[model samples]
Target chain A: MSASGRRRSQKYHQSTPYLFIAPFFLLFIPFGAGSVLLALGMSFVDWPLGQSPELVGLDKFATVLEDPLFGRAMRNTLYMLVGFLLALLPLCLLVAVLLKQLRRRTANVVQVVIFAPITMSLIAVALVFDLLYNERVGFVNGILDMIGVGPVPFLSDSDLAPWSIIALRIWRVLGYYAIILFAGLQAIPDEFYEAAELDGAGAWQRFRHVTFPLLKPVTMFVLVASSIAAWELFAEVDVLTDGGPARSTLTAVMYIFGASFEQFDLGKGAAASVVLAFAIIVSTVVAHRLLRSDDRA
Target chain B: MPKGSFAGRMGRGTVIGLIVIVTAFPLYWLLISSLKPSTRLGEVSLIPSSVTLGNYVAAFDTQIPRWMLNTFGIALLTTLLGVVVAALAGFGFARYRFRGRSLLFGVVLASLAIPEYALVLPQFTIMRQFGLLNTWAAVILPLAANALVLFLLRQYFSQLPEELFDAARLDGSGEFRLFWTIAVPLVRPGLGAAGLLLFLNAWNAYLLPLVMLTNSEQFTMPIGLAFLHSQLNFGIVEKSPWGAITAGTVISIVPLILCLLVMQRQFIGSLTAGAVKA
Candidate 1:
């Protein structure tokens, strides 16, 4: 009411926003931003656990670059990433499209069932898969035996190991990503389909000309999101394979984890982490560019 | 054929049925394998010939109860702290025009790029520095600063009508009061969604807990299972731990699966909301 009171309240309002927002920054600055910066600093030094870190600028990075295990990890990660995306993207789109045609209640129930795996502990899921993938006395091999196929070494044997891990990853996330694309499909009104039909377009044509184009944004989202997760592959491989049966399933994060925790080579771990981060960023950008370039044409 | 045709419907139905089976079978297997007798674990069967609670009884003999307690306690604390922090920040970013608003919000959004993998080493070092290693606080602290929760809540709060806040202001309500009485209650769905996501993420988290807590006594459910599993594989114990591993898997997942079932809409809806928007 009074001029001084009004001005004081105005001043208080400005600080109010900061008060509301300060908690996130309080946590973010020290934990979120600080740790990231600290990782960069840690990468430059020879920091073993429980000892003083010494500055050895770029040497850790060089060692990381030359480490054949690191190279193997990246290559395996890329191999799986491509396999994951190639398999996941189209499967998600197919599921979303089919799910779109189902009655609403039926669609929702199916979506929940499919999305259930993502909610479970990855370790628990890995254990279940490990049992399922076991060589002898395992369910998978039992079924193969029934069908006259030889017992497959899903977790053993270098060739089958990565694909086994990749299959596990796909099983967990297929429904989750599909549901997102399902929602994207839902947002595209029925009129789009009706109009396409009225124009004498067939089902495949309708999907190609209308559904596919409109769904690109969500597909791109799934592409980038799943690829990033794929690039940082760790827990499933670690628990199920330990990046093994000869390091066939070894991944970038597994490499980083081994460096930092197993060997206590924190500097090398941090450097590898930086390198992994760079790969994630570049691949993400390239994915965006790849998708975006197609948008115009 | 058009989707409306009978043949088309049959094909779609078959595919959907197969998808449901593939998705649901592992969970079903986890359940049945847990129920099988310990001696029969090596015997694969689509049906459990003899159901027994022996494995679950055996699971309790392990550190599972403590691990479950550790995981639920840590996840609950993370969800509580995470929701409150995100709500306040969401209200700020949505409701007020402050200096450094976009810049600060940009900083929050940018943190999502720093995945747990990248930050684990530094966070470990920092936790060790604070003398908090092998404690619940070590896991809860970093996870509580969740960028995704903030982003979700910010989107929720931003959609609220401005007139509600303006009316509260006219009643001489303080800024915090307006947020508490008006904006907070209005965003209950957002809160539920954010809380569920945070809880689920924390409960199922592996890497952070794996790195921070070294003591087996401090192990969360995932780490504990992994420990048992690795032990089983390496023959660290003479007798098999398969019985315990299968039973523990069931126990670890049941709570979150119940959560998912109860809040199925929010679980699916809010996640899709975040995915589409992000």
Candidate 2:
């Protein structure tokens, strides 16, 4: 074909793809990217509720730095992140490994039940957990009663509120994470296991040498995703604790929310949000880089 | 390995069975609690000796039905709009080589990393500016374009053979017709997967609805449940009806459980596909 003919055909071809993609960019320009830009612009000014917006250039960031609540929220976020990593990740991995050993039919049934909670609304989970955490009539208290132990303050005490949130997070995410890990496990060719078996490797040895190494990418992905997720934990806190009993579960997202909406301190809220987003992005980037290097090695 | 010995296999089976039971206990509890009479909700019984449907009855009488309707409407809208929009965008990114494609793709991926809460305030402000607060549009409009769904669809679309598109074009069909009849059918599995996710997300969405909808009539199930909790006066003198709350909790999760059961395979496949990607 001649160059002009080829150009004409290419133009028509390219038009189709662009037309197909227009909806996403059209929506995103207004909602996603536009909102982020607005937030960034809002962060620099003293944009309080019902007040004229004033540019305060870094003052809000300075104020957020001095605010004790900001510190407390950050601390709580870290606590929850650590709790999820320490408790949830291992439990999910263990469950996935165990499920992988089961018969296919049985595992399917178990997988459905396990993944059910992930789809359940956080509000529903919170309500159910609220019942479970009820001081007098909760199922947990009922169980404690059978054991002749005093009722543990699941959502009441500030000291224990974070743990309660963590418990809920674990329950909600374990199955989904386990499914992800199991996918990673399945991707490991059966020949690898067969080869290990020929070498007289035991199950534990096979797992350690084969499964764990192969599952690293999924594990890292889960770690970063879950950490970011745990940090942004809001619905459960809002519905269950309301960051209450002394603001024990006042996550960074909650703090940003209160600052923006409740207090109408948009500048401070934007500042906090910017900081939180930066922290997540940086941590995610660092983790990815480290994992990539390990992969290379 | 001689079947790994009967004793060892038995022990492993017992452990696996125990894990499955423990894992499913909360859902089982939800079902049992839902079935119990409203009065026996907190009576510390695993099995309800006498089951009553009054709580479900009460739920219907209260705002539960309205909440369910609102949730259903919004979720369906969000899923349909989100899937259609995402599928187009995903197809674009997968098949096209255009100006700024990489940059645009990066923006979409970045949006996935940007927490929804981070955008909620600005989104709320924008919605307020447009007088959309307390409306379903406020809830559905912002969610119409989901980066995760787009990314999933893009990956799925990219797996299709180029020859299919060529074959369709040779037949002189237009782009839209080709996509509608050929591309869509080919990507139905991906659509089903993305639809399940989008539905679950919209249904379970709390923070967006909580902030967007001010009226009780507009409240979704999660917000409605929260309102119910707040309404229960558990003061020193007044006692909360734990049975009713338990019943309410059970009612809220039933639809989600049903949806999962109906689309269990696709849901599992969608989840595992992303993780297993090389």
Candidate 3:
């Protein structure tokens, strides 16, 4: 083919691909990138609803930094993240490993049952949890009564309310995360286990040496995803507690929502969002880099 | 092979059984609570001695149906728009070699890390500017460009054998037509997986709608339920209708549960596969 002919063919090829891709960029540019920049700009000013936004230049950031409630929300978010990691991650891995050992049909049935909650609206889950945690007539309190324990303030007391929210979150997410890890577990070739068996390795040894290392990528992915999810914990708070009993469960996202809608403080809300976004970005990047380093090592 | 001891099998069975019970009990409680009579709900029992359809009836008579319709419409629209948009972008990245393709693709991947909450404020402002607040369009438009869906579809499309494109070209099929007829059908499973996920996410979305839609009538299931709960004076001496709340909760889950039952395999596959790729 001559140079001009080749160039003409390449141009035709490029045009086809560009046509195929134009819709996504066209939509995303307006919604995703545009919104992000708008939010970034909105963060710098004192913008209230129905009022002209005054350019304050980092005043909102300064306020957020000084606010006790903002500090508490940050603490609550971190606590929820840690609680989920501590409780759900290991349990999910264990369940996934156990499911991998079961008969395929039984596993599938169990998986469907466990994963049922993942599809249900968070509102429904929250309502159900609210009923379950009711101080007087809740099933949880009823069970405690049977065991001679007093009615626990699941959603009433500030200290216990956040845990109640965390409990609901853990329940909803464990099965989903387990399924993810289960897939990772399945992807490990059986031959690896077989080889380990020939070496007289016990089940624990096989899991510790073979399963854990191989599942690192999936684990890291879940960790990062769940951490980010934990940061945005709002539905349960919105429905069950509404950041009640002293704003104990007021997550950063919930705080942003309340600020924007409840107080109509768009500027401060935007600033809070920017700060939250920065925290998420920095932590995720740091976590990713650490995981990559570990992988290399 | 050495046979494991009976004790070993029993122990494993007991542990698995316990885990299943713990995982399933809350959902089972919701079902039972929904069916129990409103007056007798406080009489604690694992099995309801008397069942009544009154709670469900009351729920149906209330705003449950409206909430379901709104939620379903929003979810369906988002799924359709998201899939179509993602397919185009995915096909583009998979099939075309262009300058800055890698760089653009990286931006898409980076978007996966951007928290949805971070975008809520700006999205709300944009919706307000367009006067789309309290409308379904507010819910549907912004979510149509999901980065995860785009990335998943692109990865799946790129894995197709190059010979298929050559075969289509020989048949004089244009690139767009080839993608529509050949590539799409071949990647139906991937599309199903992505579509199902997008639908589920949209259906269950609470935070975005809570922020975007202020009108009570326009609220989705999540928001509607929250409104109901907020209105319920739990602290008042008057008897709170636990039965009705449970019934409403159960009603909210029925569609999702039915969907999961019908497409359990596809749903699970999508979730697991999406996670693996991430």
Which candidate number has the best DockQ? 1
Fnat computed for model 3: 0.68
lDDT of 3 by residue, B59-119 (tens): 8877778877898899999999999989988988998888889988888787776788888
| lDDT string, candidate 2, A226-289, tens digits | 8888878888888778888798888898899899889989889989998898888888898788
Per-residue CA lDDT of model 3 for A113-219, tens digit only, reads 88987877778888777667988768989888999997999988998887888888888888889999888888899899999999999989998889988998888
Better of 1 and 3 by DockQ: 1
User: What C-alpha lDDT values do all the predictions have?
Assistant: 0.88, 0.82, 0.83
Candidate 1 lDDT, tens digit per residue, A119-192? 88778878989778887657888788888996898988899898888899999999999999988888898898
lDDT of 2: 0.82
Rate residue A132 of model 2 by lDDT: 80
Candidate 3 interface RMSD value: 2.2
What is candidate 1's CAPRI-style docking category based on DockQ?
medium
| Chain A vs. native, model 3, TM-score | 0.92
Q: Which residues of candidate 1, in runs, are more than 4 Å off?
A: A1-11, B236-238
